[model samples]
Target: MPIHEKSLIRKENLVENESLVIDGVDVSGHWSTFITGRSLTDYNDDMQDEIAALPGGENIHRCWQCGSCTNACTVNAVNPEFNPRYWIYLIRLGMEEELLRDKDIIWQCVSCNKCTYACPRDVVPEGVMKATAHWLELKGHTPKSPSTEFDEEFSGQVIKTGKIEESRVIMNFFRRTEQPLAQPWLVALIKGLAFRFPVFYLMRMGMAVVRRPRTRNWAKSRRAINEYVQEVEAANRAAVGAKGGH
Candidate 1:
């Protein structure tokens, strides 16, 4: 028998004997490979309902496993393990343990919306990816992901100033994630851009970092938005059984 997901198999389950005899015939090497049998009884029957209650997960029930989302997913093209269709199937079936195997990479979705556009059932797989990542964090299955920290940093700036300073957002994100500002790849990219467009690059950086940008008379709008954001956060927490506020 072939396993649909080899990752789900434990290493100890595999048995291999180089020299063996069965029924007076030699059976070794590839033929000697055998997998131990086991049963899963710990299924979270409510997992699907819990995920569906979260934002962006509402349409999960609409999926028919057509696989269009995975076919059009940009991330899936580069990483075969990033299969949105498979994850959706696992979620619908309440295969919580199986889904957790890919938790670390679920947040890697770039929100390109290609999956959503190609989905015949309008599953909005991009949204489901976000929702799943959030669910993982909220349920304490995993710590707050780097993507979540970056999003909070970026959104906080936008909510407060009615705009965002790109440099500030990046710096804040790096700080929260405890990453060095002078990362090799980032430094190289910046150097390349500066070399190609010295004047424009320096001017843009100066504006984004030195002077900064803010909306005029945005205090009132900011207050209103902040209040709304708090309400939404509380509602989400209640739905997921998390604390009322961040």
Candidate 2:
């Protein structure tokens, strides 16, 4: 327990520098050299601004990737590579090509909002995920999402009709699927069991979106939204630059 004895013990454990020893493994006198290269540090400025422009993406600056978001996600338990913490880090770093290639996973996120609930900074990882999906589509990555298909079909219906027709959207959506007839049979089963419901399902959960119809001053709202998006993007670029420099 004396100082010199402890020093002797430490010396006994020490290996020649870079001798490939870890945890008592004697990898010394190795014939080969293994080069484990680190990733090149990058500055991904574009993603910050673009993501901040999304519905809940404005708060991305607050994130400090504690891995809590990924831990809180049910999907992460199923998809090992789908780490929410790493995804945000990638966006903040401006790894555009990687993100585009990763669009499939990004698009597949169920938007369960579990990550948002766990985020200490209120970074809203769920919204950032959606923002990433949109960003992927903007980069010319074709979206392979049922949600994307639903959006396209629903929009077509809305523009064609003044109101959203639930039956029509459901029918059109399933018709576009591989087994078009499966839905009608499923609907019949649901109705037979009295389980079929409408948009009011969300309303019962207190979500205002499904409960009420929205109206907008399109001309004014459009201009205002565009300006806000521009400002957030500028701020995000500045933040990313500052962080990268540090």
Best by lDDT: 1
Give the Cα error of residue 183 in candidate 1, in Å: 2.0
**Poorest 10 consecutive residues by lDDT, candidate 1:** 1-10
Q: Give the TM-score of candidate 1.
A: 0.83
Candidate 1 lDDT, 1-246, residue by residue in tens: 234455676777877778888898788765767787679788878777778887899899999999999999999999999999999999998899899999999999999999999999888899899989988888888888998999999999998888998889989899999999999999999999999999999998887777768898999999999999888777777778887444
CA RMSD per model (angstroms): 3.4, 11.3
- Candidate 2 lDDT tens digits, 1-246: 013333433343433434556566655543223333347556556677877776567787788979889999978899876887888887787776566646788776788899988889999898888766765555446644777778778865544433466656777787775446556878687566555554555445345334433344455655665577567555544544422210
Best by TM-score: 1
**Residue 149 local lDDT, model 1:** 98
In model 1, the clashing pairs are: none
- Each model's TM-score? 0.83, 0.58
**Model 1 spans with C-alpha error above 4 angstroms:** 1-34, 189-210, 244-246
